[model samples]
Target: MGSGKHRWKISIYRSTGKPETRNPNPPTEFICPISGLLMADPVIVSTGQTFERACVTACKTLGYNPILKDGSIPDLSIVIPNLALKSSIFNWARASMTDPPKAVELADALKLVRPAMAENGEIENGVLGELLIGRVEEDNRGSNLLEHAESELTRRQTGFDSCESLSGSFRKTPLALATRPSCYSSCSSSSELDAPAVGACEDGEEYVGKLRSSHVYEQEQGVVGLRKATRSSEDLRLSLCTPRLLSALRPLITSKYNNIQINSVAALVNLSLQKLNKVKIVRAGFVPLLIDVLRGRFPEAQEHACGALFSLALDDANKTAIGVLGALQPLVHIMIRSESERARHDAALALYHLSLVQSNRLKLVKLGSVQLFLGMVKSGQMPGRALLILCNLAACNEGRGAMLDAGAVEFFVGLLREGGFDSESTRESCVAAISALSYGGGLRFRGLAKAAGAVEVLRDVAEQTGRERARDKARRVLEILKAREEEEEEDVDWEKVLELGFPSRTLTRVGGQSCRNSSEF
Candidate 1:
């Protein structure tokens, strides 16, 4: 009886330790809003919602911009890694005495969110159907949305049929399935899908489907073809930038193969050039991936990633999101350290556009970018691009302060004094930066310019510079300096009159003799 009692206690302890018997309902914040599971790798999206990274990627792949319980659609463009939430989740799991939730694989995430299949095993003719038909619906503001999926289903049926008729080869079918068929299924095996027979697959949908294939070679072919198509055709760029295509291309940006990574990132750069696609690409969460590529080992992929960021930053809607997603530091690093000239150039341009946003300018200043770029200018490395960024920075108070603190006055004056830049634009940019600084930095700028001998340099530039804008900016700087000097002298004169207890103008010296002006006094 004693042995049996002991055995019962041991069994009870083991049962309590099992994962199934643990608390099934965790805290609400611990659960991913999209996956409805504990977030293993939580991230904060642009809309300020926390979700599992895989779930967000899967949703983007399906082009499902779901209206949340609050009736607000989440913007997926910029996903910042939520390490704090992730740490809290693990702590909660540990305290609850249960195994932490495992990461949701891309395949599992797709299965969870992809449109439901029909009872007859045929793909349901709704959301997935419209997507297969390549029908993109836009709101009055030209923003793409999935609101009209069911209403347009019938109208798009003929279009899908026509596309199907044109691509008679089963290999050319653009349909992408969420599930991996088993051995007994009639669907093509993974081995066959991975084959290297990339033919003239012109349709964007077909290439997207190939991109989702399990085989690396097929994905390479898909991205290469997609890149080529989107490069020249503006229509293809508009049509091919679906969440599905972007999600498929996302992981490939970090792929191990050089050809795959380079082509995938280049394809993204090509797609980002379209105005309609810019915000969509960002909302689909491409910015973080692009930042990762900028920090990655692949040089060619990094160049394309820089170009993609530059392209995306051109959109006003994307500017803040890009900066908020932690892009500024990497951009600055690449702009300074990247060996590829194209990468550095694009990174600098990306910084320029991003700094147009006031928040990004503050961020750039916080990241100590002002000094970094100023140093680049002094070293003759990307001086034009760096100056352009500095000009944008000077538009904000924090940036203006940082530029002055970094001794930018002397740098610009020195550059002008040296007088042999590659183009008139470089000189114009430096003059513009100086003008901005002088306008914003107030008395501090006046002191810095006076100390750096900027007054004489500006006079030379104002009289000799070929570009009208450069000459104008130089003259503006000179005017500011003259105004400041006059103001200082006026302050001194007023102080002298106040000390003497009478207006200085009241007592005038006529031929070394004092002449009193009582009426003026």
Candidate 2:
């Protein structure tokens, strides 16, 4: 290659010297060493290696370079932004799907189906699993389909059909069973028995009455189509298709086709794993649909909905919106009433997220969540999350007041000291709750802490803990109670809330989380 008057020699490696078949994918150096995701914010660390900024910051904070044995960097501030690499990544991402592979086309066109005979309502053993597994195998093979679909979908920017239109295929004729003709008993096995059609055929071919076609059969076809679509998109695991997929699946979820709804919800569960997809799904009207499923009679759908909401709620931005849309009422119901252990555990996890925010904490405590956590703690149902919820509640003064009134301080502390809970997280959570209640809730909390025998537990943990985090947290609580028992205290302020490592959480709990208000944004 010639550069301005200077010539440079570069060697190229190719198994076959065919330029047409040479792979065009990005080099391994372009990927973040820590995250393995494409580097949108690539930076060079002090170790002379580049990685995504977020991953670098986390790694540096842990005092080590993930890729090198160089124990720790002097500082992370020396990192440099890799703009040239970032631009190259952008170009690659844009052109990535331009040349689509043939496997993608075949996978999209593929169908898993049975003939009309399935209308008999009798499922042959192992047939359904084979069909679904076959479709999944195809989807798994066509790895590039989802990326192509996303690019194609974004280029068009089209909208999906309405709920009614989606339900069109579901409104079908009821299933009907076909009965055998009575004359079949006397019919001979073979040989040209020309007689009444029920008994025999003129050419020895069996004669039968006309079979009724069921709309149920047609609905099954629609469900199979959607299921295949969902499986393909789900297999790709890319957030790029999230919006379009949500648009397509939203209406299908409301359809009476149970299988269609199940597949759609399951697809949403997969899509919501993408951090960017959570807001889009919520905006496209998924939270309410999930809440409906959580309240539905189907335990499987309930578990899926609960799990999806739990993942979405991991993004603090979506928590209040989920709760604001009347999710709290039935979420609480599921925690208290759902028959499935997995459903109840998932519900508890969802509540753990909801309780992270101040207003939601207040609302939950007001709605009998304190008692709910108390019961869950006793039953071993997501005990870590239960304790975490109790701790988050104790962050606010009003919540602390309610929790103290409900005798949670004693329960949490006792659970910690007695080794009743085996998890380090649970034990740490109990200690953290005592810290929040001890330092910020005034003299009443100190007196209450001692009355609950928290001092003994704190001393035990501070003196005998293996985990440094737990030991430090316990020591902090012990200092607050011992050094300044009567120090002036107030509720958790906005600054304290920020210090607690929840910025986005405070945003929604306060106000202005609506996705619809574009102007405010």
Candidate 3:
């Protein structure tokens, strides 16, 4: 390590690429049921199952309650710090001349837990668990217990120097720590986490394999190459999106290294651009990872995450799944709070497409997106995009009611009257939304439109706008406004006929045949 500050980075090596040579006979009690890795910060859930804290957080984040090997489902509602277990694991590491296990990062832990969770929380022989164990054996080349213990001692004595030399050969670490763990001090120096030169290989599979490498530099190179390859070639994107590759790329999307996280997400965005890959990516379970990046601290990564999600949302097949995966709240949050204009733009478009799904429309309405989008439009911040989403939202009953209640008719009619919109498309979106709200809008719709002076503005749109769609929508809304206005202007009050107490059949005869006075009846 470079200094006392960099000492923690050494701890990350134990969990990343190849399996570290651990004490072959370490106590089973020291291992986390969720991660199978030695526990650094163990805690007892209400179910009395002990797990690494990061693992528990991952389960909670995924809304997965894992069934341990003993077939016990951990009640994650209450977690108590297992100080004694933590101390024991620490003591074991020191006694074995191995570094104490570092807490797994939440992002990495999520990857570990996901495979097991997918198999109904069966941790033993789970897909990822097996892949991890296999990689450990393959990477270590069956190094004997004596050699492993010697290597740990040697690594500690040489400090940063050995870390640099062994950087490419280091074994992968399993599981991660907290959301933003301090384990990796970020070996940003060229001499430390140096990436192999790009263009050494053009094979996308090779790049995917590099992603699985325990070497930080190698993983960065792999993701960067994959990003470039996918960006330029459509064929490569389709070919590169295999399940194995996606599983490997998942963890890096949340890598602590800025280079890895940014490029990994950008690569995923490129991969998601392919039409066929959309559903595969979603079914493979990457939505939550992208969401993590969207809510993560890295701005560039967040931008790419939004782009990936928007690309996925372009497919009609993925809309409901994306919405069900808990994407709405974060996408809405990004629309409002992201400083990056690109992130906000993509997030808004994604929401617009997602709202095309009926359930997502209701979810958006419940999320208070109507008011949020209206406010954004009012503030002239991404007005076009926000309005487009609002247009989609208005297509549903819940969304229509929410928009009506939010004064959408007045707001949109005002926009049209003032001719404040910058583009015809934006104006068209407003008109389309108004048209949606007007359908099945009985008296209240008539009242709102009349008050907003919608008939005059819509008449202008129908007569003046060159875009045929806007013209058609305007004409439709104008029809609604005029029809309702005519109904309101009618002089007859049907209530008086009922109050007169005429015989019902006689009244029907009077209306259907010739009108007759009550005296004739």
The clash count for each model shown is 4, 0, 16
State the C-alpha lDDT per candidate.
0.68, 0.53, 0.69
TM-score of each: 0.58, 0.51, 0.58
Per-residue accuracy of model 1 over 1-521 as CA lDDT, tens digit each:
99999999978977887554466578999998767899999998754678999988776655454445543445565679999999999998887776888999999987876642232133422234324323321112111111111111111110111122111111111123211101111222233244343554456679878888998767878877776666556567778888877887888888888778777877787677565688999998888888888888888778778878887885667889999999999989998998976677667767766776678988888888888888898888877778777877886788888888878888889888988986666777787778777753388888889899998999998798396656766776787678778877976776676667654354557677776664453
List candidate 3 stretches off by more than 4 Å. 1-196, 200-205, 485-521
Q: 1-521, model 3: which lDDT tens digit per residue? A: 36865766666755575764666567999888889999998998644568899998887655455654432344464579999988888887886768779889999998998787557533322133223322333123223212322221111110111122211111211121111101111122232234444763556578767999999878988877776666546567778888889999999989999888887887787677555688899998999998988888888778778878877885656888999999999999998999976677668767766776678889999999999999998999877778777866775678878988999999989998888676665676677667767766468888899898988888898899376657766776676667666775596566876688665333346447755556554
| lDDT for residue 16 in candidate 3, whole number 0-100 | 70
Write one digit per residue (lDDT tens) for candidate 2, span 262-353: 54565566556444566777888888888778766556567667767876775556777887887877877887777865566556667765
Q: Order of candidates by lDDT, top first? A: 3, 1, 2
Q: What is candidate 2's CA lDDT for residue 285?
A: 86
